[model samples]
Target: MSHLEREIAEQPQVLRTLLRAQAAPVGAIAAAIKRFQPAFVQIAARGTSDNAARYAQYLMGIVLRMPVGLAAPSVHTLYGAQPNLARALVIGISQSGKSVDVLQVISDARAQGALTLSITNDANSPLAQAAEYHIPLHAGEERAVAATKTYTAELAAVALLVTALADDDAMRAALNAVPDALDATLTLCDPIAGWAQRYRYMPQLACIGRGYNYCTAFEINLKVTELCYITGVGFSEADFLHGPIAQISPGFPVLVVAPSGKTLPTLLTFLEKLKARQAEALVIASDEAAFVHAQQQMRIPAATPEWLTPITAVMPGQVFAMQLAAAKGYDLDNPLGLTKVTLTL
Candidate 1:
């Protein structure tokens, strides 16, 4: 195993601690978001932050019934916006709050009259200093650059924030129990890492998820690209069958963050198509339907409320990425050309 992999393997205990440590702030941030209640909510992040952006958008739309939009950090500062950004509530998420672009945009948003909030791991970082409110993930020092606990913590933090805003008692309960969900997901680590090590060289990998796990699919692709430096894509299962299936052939590996909702029938249909194409496939799910089979499988504990399966489903994938990167001796702690924070315009 690479140094980063060893570091990650040693991290679950620490991660569990971080998860327990941040519950209050997570809840508080959600409540703070509700208080803002601006004309609209704007999210900014590059790469993985972009993944987080998608999750934020999904949750706000799916769970909170709010309209959430995405904006790159550059647009608020350098790109020039047509509409007044003055009343928009912008929440910029960065693991390290100091990236040049992120900082510039937070300043621009403020100058235009928007309420800016920074969700970061470092409260002392530039991005955190620029925003009016800071929701630190409290994830502590992440040793490997390819984020693991920090990203999960950020997801939990966002969930807490949204739950607070929408008076979602059910979601609030989910947030409280998330660490347990995370633990259940971790149990699949050995199996997932085995897959990663075995398939490290597989060409053209695809990941699919429906509903909330869609964001998890995005995150898995991000980890693969950043660490293993592979060409990977995350798509909705149904959408993939429509056009993307042409790219899948023998030896191509696919990952499905199988949905637990009504989408299961659709997922199984897509799986059949994948089978017909003779492509390799992996599925992550918890449903105990009367029938189930796949080319490869990683099962997480069944999560409550079904749509929240992403909370549990993403753990093994993160571990899988870490192990694959470790096998290649890739630097997981600090991925090439990236930092803990991006203070952008």
Candidate 2:
């Protein structure tokens, strides 16, 4: 197996290891955050980590009721602008703890007396060292140039923090089922391996999702672009209807992530419209009703908490991207000029 494929297969075990080891440390951080009582939250990340941060925005907002902001590293790194973060909880997330700008954001937030935390695979790396607390991803040495396991590990780390803060036993139990859910989800790779051949010549596509899975759309698009070199765009269901829907014509390809949740109804409506326009859509949904509106369907495990669906729903899309890359005769483990760690500013 290629490094990418192995890393992808390793996610279930990686998450299981993380949940077993991180609960207590994560709980301590949660205790600290409760004591600090920050007014809002700010996160610093880039690339795939940035997409994980997007999941944080929705998860923290809905579950913890804490407003969250994505930091523009340029403000601190290039323009030298220091926004007062004293009353905020600032978080830095990176697979490698080496993103210069993300590290600078954590360092500055710490200096400004903000409660700072970092989630990274490297516990000894600089970003972890700069933060007041750290939650190690425990995803192991991910040799894939395109991240597979680390991205899901990041999502789980964020969810672990939220579950710790909530201190709800039922939610904790729900989280324990995630590894099994992921293992079940991985079976989609078999079907994707065959289905991807149909899209071998697909030049471009749109990926759509709403609510928590909004991040899934973008992250899946990133994977497709990285591995298959597809010109893919991601959009929220509403955003696509507003203007971008005009761009869709008969036989246009669209990929969607609409698991069984509150988001499914509206997504079904969106798919209906796409059907009217004769778009060829492959929808990832757990609901039987949703299948009626698509040319193709991939089902994930049903009843995954809406907040955590992004964690489970993304796996099938990753498999599709991997298979699609193989179908197109493109590099999977190492894309054209990409590297595993990217440093900015």
TM-score of 1: 0.88
What lDDT score is found at residue 119 in candidate 1? Answer: 83
- Against the unseen true structure, what C-alpha lDDT does each candidate score? 0.72, 0.92
**Model 2 whole-model lDDT (C-alpha atoms):** 0.92
Highest lDDT: which candidate? 2
Q: What's every prediction's RMSD, in angstroms?
A: 2.8, 0.9
Error of 2 at 185 (Å): 0.5
Over 121-163, each residue of candidate 2 has an lDDT whose tens digit, in order, gives 9999999999999999999999989998999999999999999
Clash totals, every prediction:
21, 0
TM-score of each: 0.88, 0.98
TM-score of candidate 2 against the unseen true structure? 0.98
Model 2 misplaced regions, further than 4 Å: none
